[model samples]
Target: MKKTRIAALAAVLAFAGATLPASAQTALSENQILQSLQSAARVAPPNLSAALIANAVQEHIKNNPGMPITWTPLQLLDGLAQINVQIQFALNSDIIRPESYATIGSIADALHHPILAGYKFVVTGNTDTTGDRMKNLELSQRRANAVMNALVTVFNVDPARLEAVGLGQENLQDVQNPTDPINRRVQLINVGKYLPGK
Candidate 1:
């Protein structure tokens, strides 16, 4: 199952003309991130509601706790323009590690690119299945919040354009091996356009 997911993700990235890094630690350049995002946005669903998506994830976590999520809701996002990058945090804490600042900065640059200015994004935090499920969920949310806050306050991104959600181990990238570090990641998803007049 994990291999299948990985192959599928690779295929999607390839089709989009994006290259997947060998590991999460490899830094993606601003142009690479920008191009990947732009490609994804071109085919993304129109007018997705970040609030609704956040609420659904929260509801699922509250109801299912540690259970692996089914594909129904996740499938909706599978076709969206999204990229998962590793963001290092302090052990059992939400503090952003200094080494990951470059990656975050690159993401901000991509978000600020002219082509992406009108799009809204979801910043989702995920964790490997190595700790308490509920606690992991909370920690993931805090980490996601931290990243979003940095983008808004430090990088001058519009707060209204981003939403943060934590899925913990519910949607493990490597379902067969829940403890894989690849499961621990921050996903930036281009949800839809941000129209103030709506």
Candidate 2:
């Protein structure tokens, strides 16, 4: 039942166009992020391991070439509750651009919300196919780390609640046009509960 709702939401997000250009992007409010994440979590599958999710992402990238990959690869994450936000970075670098700070702040705010306190999230970075796959993977990791760091250091989010991964160009939002800007995004996925015993 949960899986069904997740799939339906994912389809809507896929078709409704999740990504927006930086110039036209509006910062998602803290309440908006919180609500979307909470709704997603309510219908999310239980006990999704971070390591398993990471392995799936890695396997997807390994099996598919960056330039001609399909949205099919994203099925690994299809039933998860996730949101993609456009996070701008300096050219070929992981430095979060100033314009995106507000968006980052909203993410942090959402993470700090009381209703989401029991959840852990994965910060997955993706890149458009504009450069070497290896290089893009590295940059994406750094960018993901940067966002995680900001959430922890600046917004007081618990470090234990976040994991960062970079998928590079392996999962293109715009598979028909690999180099499309929409392919580059940061995804925040609610992986599971914060298991203190783990």
Candidate 3:
């Protein structure tokens, strides 16, 4: 099952990269990957698949707190799952609802941990499939930027270490039912390597 999930994730990332402009595909950096993923999130369902794979990776990490450093991107993602925070925003708007303050606080706390020093991350926003695709994508991007701003302004996280991207409804958590609430979520993808004792 782990192998299958890993393969699925690799395939999904590959397909996502293939969809980007040729100029953007030459050398894929973390920023490029984030950009490609965001673009794919706007027009394809692969983000949903990526999220599912990430969720599984997170679960694995949760089950084994002593996960080794010699792991794949999926495993590294699972191992560094602190970025999988859930924050709620106002309906159709980038404004975060009051009820989500706790989650935001937790994210702030996690990022402040000593172990995460020097780490760089990208904040990603995803949406359910309910409106115009382009609009949804734009909203997702705005929400992501909002989260990034909140973390930097409110939590004192270094702005240089963060980037925000929105993946619109291109990756619905429940494709068969695009309106599923689970589809709306915020995820943080690390741009730096995980150095356990750093």
Candidate 4:
């Protein structure tokens, strides 16, 4: 029985040797490795290993090029600090249209979740050139503030976690059209110190 256990441990070590990151593989102590394995045993289900999850994350990145994903859960054992969120608006309106409630709810849920709870957001409002530039600027600022209020009051995001600002028609999405629907949007860029954990 002891021999079989040693053999299994050896096999696990060899498997780790083949796939573990250089940082982890080199510095991870025997106890740490065993603990990691034990944790893995509890969390990983049948047909799924830590390596398989790593592979899926890699494949997801390879399959979807130009995305901002760089790390996986295996790498993010250390907690994250903050995250970004973007929301869009109609022309000259501060109200989050009823149709976009679901998306807004998802953002709230993400903000409330354990992974992204600590993050702060800058809710930037943008607009198309369908109206006067100065008016668009003022309107955009109002829209941005409205969004901030909705997120804080309606969605229950921490007021400290949000900042609302307006860019007006400055950063046009479809520069060629100058007033495209795609331009009328908000992008929640991860501002301070958070990367998307896969």
Candidate 5:
């Protein structure tokens, strides 16, 4: 039994040592290395954006040459930190319109991809400075939450992996025009680790 246990430990050690890259070991201490190796053993699921999925499909087709690709669960969830989708709600209200479906659907589709199954994201709502500061903040929060709810209830995305926050007029893309429609936007940020297990 002792010999069998020793063999098992040896095999585990071998696997751990084999999987870790040399460059990764350069900065980590012995304890950190052990922790990292243990974490690495766990397979992380992919969480992706719709734009990224689309780009990945395009690349896949390019590489394969002469094959059609389906958009269902596109199996993509890597590359890029953010994808900007234009999602607009009704003016002065948090009601999402039918015209917004194309962009929102894309976002939902990305979150539904299997490659990005375990990923978490932040959906930030921003508003123009045309309204009172406090009201704008509250409005933005509502808009953000509305989008989050849509992703959860309508798209079947994992609610636990999504968070909504309101930036209000704080980070306006159009600095010159406080009332610019461009200032009113929702930004999706992938809060997941880029390389995972860092």
Candidate 6:
């Protein structure tokens, strides 16, 4: 695929530089590859996309205290497993809800520890099944803020260490069912982590 795009771009450049040698196209491809590599390096080390981080947040936190890294998105239920990083809430409610607190709390707890200290995070709010797009967006923002505030005020999480944002209803349907109960969630994303893989 990369070769294809490079070839296509080279062809265009070749067309414009008709008087130049065909070899010039090779330089263009080289340049294209160089740029691509540079960009990839920027997000290398399994850079977690917002989607993955969001999914992880919604999952229930069931990690052991000994582990350096815990992913709640991988909880098991009656032989079935639930992904951490996503937590559900009632319509229009910014409440941390129940059991769900375990997930977010563990994350805040992890960040509070000395090993993972110095990292930052984001609390993104989402909603499903009950409001107009604009209204949902506003509510989502409120919820995100509420969740962030809870982490800071109640859990002793640092205020400067986190951000709260509302994705509204977008990115929810990107997974399976758009209107499913699982779609309503809050995704916690860690800073300097979950970047794209090389």
- Give the higher-TM-score candidate: 5 or 6: 5
Supply the global lDDT for candidate 3: 0.53
List the lowest-lDDT window of 10 residues for candidate 5.
10-19
Per lDDT, the best of the predicted structures is 2
TM-score of 4: 0.51
The residue pairs in collision within model 3 are: none
Instruction: Judging by lDDT, tell me the better candidate of 1 and 4.
Output: 1
Models sorted by lDDT, best on top: 2, 1, 3, 5, 6, 4
RMSD of 2: 7.2
**Candidate 6 — which residues are off by over 4 angstroms?**
1-84, 88-90, 173-176, 193-198
Candidate 3 local lDDT, 1-198, one digit each (tens): 323322222222222112232222133333333333323222212222334543544454455344122222233233332223346788788999876655555455555655555465668787766677568778988998898899899778877667777766554344554565556667766555433443
For residues 70-129, what per-residue lDDT tens digits would candidate 1 score against the true structure?
422354466577777777899988999986766676677668768899988989888877
**Tens digits of per-residue lDDT for model 4 on 8-40?**
332322221123321222333334323332232
lDDT of 6 by residue, 1-198 (tens): 434433443332221112233233333453542232222213322433334544443332222223233222221111111111455466467766775555455545555655445544566666653557557767877888887887788779877666776656553522334455444556554444312232
Task: Specify the poorest-scoring 10-residue window by lDDT in model 3.
Answer: 16-25
lDDT comparison, 1 vs 2, better candidate = 2
Task: Supply candidate 5's per-residue lDDT for 121.
Answer: 72
Between prediction 3 and prediction 4, which has the larger lDDT? 3
Off by over 4 Å in 4: 1-91, 193-198
Ranked by lDDT, the better of candidates 3 and 6 is: 3
Model 4, residue 24: C-alpha shift (Å):
41
Candidate 2 lDDT over residue span 1-198, tens digit each: 323323332322221134444334444444455556656524545666546666776777677755454555466566466777777789888898986766676677667667889988888888888988888888888899998988788778899899888877776666666788877888888877788767
Q: Identify the superior model by TM-score, candidate 1 or candidate 2.
A: 2
Clashing pairs in 2: none
lDDT of each: 0.69, 0.70, 0.53, 0.47, 0.53, 0.47
**Candidate 5, which segments miss by more than 4 Å at Cα?**
1-80, 193-198
